[model samples]
Target: MKVLVYWAAVVVALALVAAAGGGQVAMAAVRCSPAELSSCASAITTASPPSRLCCRKLREQKPCLCNYLKNPTLGKFVNTPNARKVAAACRTPFPKC
Candidate 1:
């Protein structure tokens, strides 16, 4: 469908923009879903390097890090040293929350 194609294009564009630069994507329409962090999970749980997608998602989700930390279920995971390392690697600085 046209709508699906358009949305897919938008996603690809956003990803491309994110991968090509650092900091926020300048799109406040960012989805605040914590599940987006899944891209960084393997790196967060181990010593592996974060993929481009992982860094992109982390940058996109920077605005929501405090909220994620406020979540009891996600708090523990977000607070780990490994998680911080992943964020640092992504250049997505771990929030002070």
Candidate 2:
């Protein structure tokens, strides 16, 4: 569990870096890895409020959200009502995708 959360945080971070839009430099730094969103899994899967870490990662990964939503493997999870609640709790806007 800890390991998963750790990986998820990393993913969100990468997405954040990419969204930062530093041009090529930023793109290189961006990861957009879905694994990084692991930290939010528990909150999104359960009724628990999102943790600070989860919220932070959600913010960081905000740019990659649309891609995640478009992904067949991950779209379902990202589109869930629970996921929306988690996003709301974290103050991260849910992607239109």
Candidate 3:
């Protein structure tokens, strides 16, 4: 009856929403690794403005910032004033972690 059809439509809509959400999650999967931040090292260490490539990499790697902060070796470099400046220029928010 009409109720059965309505329930089927609701299930289809829910499935579509779930599929779209899964695509977003997959897209957000860290495309850039922490090691790729090295492209910005000179700017980070010397207070120079970041290059276009550096900014692109920074944005791509934004999600990995917290992980970098947790790493002792990487944390020292990422937590520096120069690094913060570079990140700001790139419009990448420095994670609290």
Candidate 4:
């Protein structure tokens, strides 16, 4: 009986870990498009908080931030104070791009 209880607890712990891991994987797979970013840029530049869809795009584009920051033309938009403000408003940490 003791062994059965221990095994049950172990299985429960493993299941919880697997569920959390799957959530992270799902988030990581999210993606964004140029149109999505453009839709949010104006509001972001004006210091308005980004909408839910805009914030979702931002997270989806997280992997591209550094690359975008390296472009002379795009860098201006990504490196602005307004961009940071929007990111903060969305509760998403800005990537160190």
Candidate 5:
């Protein structure tokens, strides 16, 4: 009986850990792929206001901004003044990383 109780407690603890970590996994599944921000390309390169679609994408991609900034190929584009403008226009807080 004691062994069974110990096993049950272990299982419950593992389940709790998995549940807590699942949210991070789900977040990680969505990447900061530059392709995802294609809608904002024009706004980023030009002085035109960002479109609704661009703002939506920017909001969705906010969590990945730091990762994008760290990427050599995407860093230049993501760290640009225009990109920052778009982020400001969209009301998405830019990641400092």
Candidate 6:
């Protein structure tokens, strides 16, 4: 019983670490201003990949993805594959929004 409990605790801890490192929480830090969004929108729409400014905004808005994901309307934009591509181009990992 003791061994089983200890293993369960370890498993839970590891799972938490993996989830956090997967960028779900880190994405909360990555948002853009309206001006920044305007500029970023073109690139995002064109699928040209994100620029440095876009990447900065992405990191800034990172924290918001989970919330955005929870919203049906906003989730479409936040959860797109293009967004993930932009993130990759920017060297920012795609958060599991």
Residue-level lDDT of model 5, residues 1-97, one tens digit each, is: 5645553554454345334542123355664444557677677777579999999988877777776677564576689898889999999988886
Once model 3 is optimally superposed onto the true structure by TM-score, how far is the C-alpha of residue 88 displaced, in angstroms? Answer: 0.9
TM-score of each: 0.69, 0.69, 0.66, 0.61, 0.68, 0.56
The Cα local distance difference test for each model comes to: 0.70, 0.70, 0.66, 0.60, 0.68, 0.55
Q: Regarding lDDT, does 1 or 6 come out ahead?
A: 1
Name the weakest run of 10 consecutive residues (lDDT summed) in model 3: 18-27
Candidate 5 or 3, higher lDDT: 5
Candidate 5: residue 28 Cα off by (Å): 4.9
Clashing pairs in 5: none
Clashes of 6: 13
- Worst lDDT run of 10 residues, candidate 5, spans 17-26
How much does candidate 3 score in TM-score? Answer: 0.66
lDDT of 4 at 91: 76
lDDT for 41 in candidate 2 is 75
Q: For candidate 2, report its TM-score.
A: 0.69
lDDT of 6 by residue, 1-97 (tens): 5645553554454345335543234333443222233334545556875677888877666565566566554456557777678878877776764
| Clashing residue pairs found in predicted model 1 | none
Give candidate 1 regions above 4 Å deviation: 1-27
Q: What tens-digit string does per-residue lDDT give for candidate 4 at 17-39?
A: 33454212223564322333654
lDDT at residue 78 of model 6 (Cα atoms): 55
Model 4 clash pairs? none
Residue 64 displacement in candidate 5 (angstroms): 0.8
For each of the candidates, the C-alpha root-mean-square deviation to the true structure, in angstroms, is: 10.6, 6.7, 18.5, 18.0, 17.5, 16.4
**Stretches of candidate 2 exceeding 4 Å from the true structure:** 1-29
